[model samples]
Target: MPRQPLVRPGRKLGAVALDVSSSHRAWLDPTRETYLASGRTLGELGDRIPLAKSKLSELLRGVGLYPRWEVIHRLAAELDMPSWPLHRLWRQAALDAGKAPEWIDRSTRASAATARRRPPLDHDGLRQLVEHDYRFYAQVFLCDDERDIAVQDTFAALWLRWDTALCSPDIRAFAWSILRATVMARATYRDGRPELEAAVFDTVALQTQISPSAGAARMTRLVELFRAISRLPVTQLDTMVLLHLCGFTAERASGLLGVPLAAVRADERRAMRHLESAVTLKPDTEGPIT
Candidate 1:
């Protein structure tokens, strides 16, 4: 009699074939040597990666719905390998294994609100800017109390370093750096990439009045646009959010981000080009932008 493979639950819907799973496992084959360098039993590898034996076997064998990108990330760290390349493979495998875009999107967002521990302070000069920036963070993080904490921490850090920031060539830029770092630290990551998936819905650019039953083609193109916006380069993403969502001028965004005005414009062009490519991806299926 022939041997049958183990069936993973939740994968019965558009599940990936066993060979695809095996190939993905083979791609991570190096983890075996990194595990023991003399080859490793699944039990040994599981303990080394600090994963449950059953779960580890499922991942190593790709016998289940693909594990979350974070799991692969942790495994990479355990193996002392750079995670970026592995991240790409993990994403490809997930997509090829029939993970829906919606599923992937949900998996990529932060599961919980961020906790910012710093207490708030009153800074007269930065107060208005802080309020404005708070709205931006609120839109991005989409959590009430926790998003407030993130903004409060940014302002508090800036106030503490006010003197140092004042002495810098660009105080706003210095403050911007602090804000950027803090927000990124709290941002959700997938396959080693920080994600701003919230921009798909909450961003001001998405505020146009369009009904649910709007033309099917237009809506489809709109969906593609949202997808592109969510994946822009970090700098470009920030630029678009500032310009369209936050109503900031190019000069103002340049000041807040510490990027030169020319570069900011360049990123805008690049972002638009990327969007164009995505929306026109099939050409035949493309619809009017307006």
Candidate 2:
């Protein structure tokens, strides 16, 4: 089969290592039954295997293993939940916590009870989850399309920046600026994204102005602009948003992102190259525009 092009635009490629675990093996792998028998949560198993806690949690949640089962059979087979009197034990615990009686069957209340007893996240963990799951600080600029949701979901999945140190006023200011850019990009999607991005880069004074042109004309301009830049990959998109859309100085964007200034400069060049490529790749009107 042919490989798919890396379709997600504006994603950071190396933010989190894919090989976040020190051990090559997965406890959930069929060969690792002995390791799984250690009777630990994936988080605990992650510690022994030297996987990042966040990565481990993501894996478990992705596979539908978290929240412990409300059904005993599911708990046993799907989650490898403990075999001992699991149902009665957890059920009564749930009753003690005053959870709804109908929420648990008699056979599985014990698991729910155990789940209720768990404590809340620490401040750092809560922040990490927000950043990782929601892409709290990442920004995106997109042309109007029904497919825009895919871009948003891609950013949300890749975001992993969660340092409480960023709560300082200066850093918070920077974060807010990025967020505002993302919000503005979304707000303008129905109008024109590419034209907005071009104005942002080439004429800052024009960026905040929505042209007095009629809506359809404005949308046409935006579509033309996005089409002009479509062949660029993730790096150029990142640079364009930081420098043009967000109005960050090149030095400032480089410093905040910890990338070299030259890399940022190269990104602008690469973006132009992609625009040239896209212009030459004419669209077939008979096919759906993607």
What RMSD value applies to candidate 2?
A: 15.2
Residue-wise C-alpha lDDT for candidate 1, range 158-214, written one tens digit per residue = 553444466678766777776766566556666655554555445554544444355
Instruction: Identify the candidate with maximal TM-score.
Output: 1
lDDT of 2 by residue, 179-204 (tens): 33433434334334332343322333
List candidate 2 stretches off by more than 4 Å.
1-61, 64-206, 214-218, 276-290
Candidate 2 worst ten-residue window by lDDT: 22-31
Q: Which candidate tops lDDT?
A: 1
| TM match of model 2 to true structure | 0.36
